[model samples]
Target: MASTRQIITDLRAQARALDGRHLSGSMMDGVCRSLRRGADELDRLLGELAMLRAFAEIPGDAE
Candidate 1:
């Protein structure tokens, strides 16, 4: 299975390919925007997960 980061990379590539083609007000334009937003969301999710992992790795007072 592909990792989240890898998926985001592919998504960004696809988005870039669809971008800036003067397809304003068209379905392809909408698709490109949606793909970009999806990638942005996934990136944020990865950051949140990494932050949680870092917190988990820290030494706790109870430990």
Candidate 2:
């Protein structure tokens, strides 16, 4: 599994990659879909990260 920070870094790179590309209409649509998926994935990962941190903060949990 990837760390949340690395996934965010990759998403930023993908956003940067969208610049200066000569994409056809369909290709641009596909790229937009991919970016949307990435955004959704990032949201999920962030949620999981938050949950993990919350769980970790609880005292006296079994190891």
Clashing pairs in 1: none
What is candidate 1's TM-score against the reference? 0.74
Report the poorest 10 consecutive residues by lDDT, candidate 1.
Answer: 54-63
Model 2 clash tally?
A: 0
As for model 2, its CA RMSD to the true structure in angstroms is: 5.1
The residue-by-residue lDDT of candidate 1 on 1-63, one tens digit each, is 788888999998998898766565555777788888999999999887777767888533221
lDDT of candidate 2 at residue 5, scale 0 to 100: 58
**How does each model score on lDDT?**
0.79, 0.65
Question: Model 1, stretches more than 4 Å misplaced?
Answer: 20-27, 58-63
- In candidate 2, where is summed lDDT lowest over 10 consecutive residues? 54-63
**By TM-score, how accurate is candidate 2?**
0.51
> Over the stretch 40-59, how does candidate 2's per-residue lDDT look in tens digits?
78878777767886788843
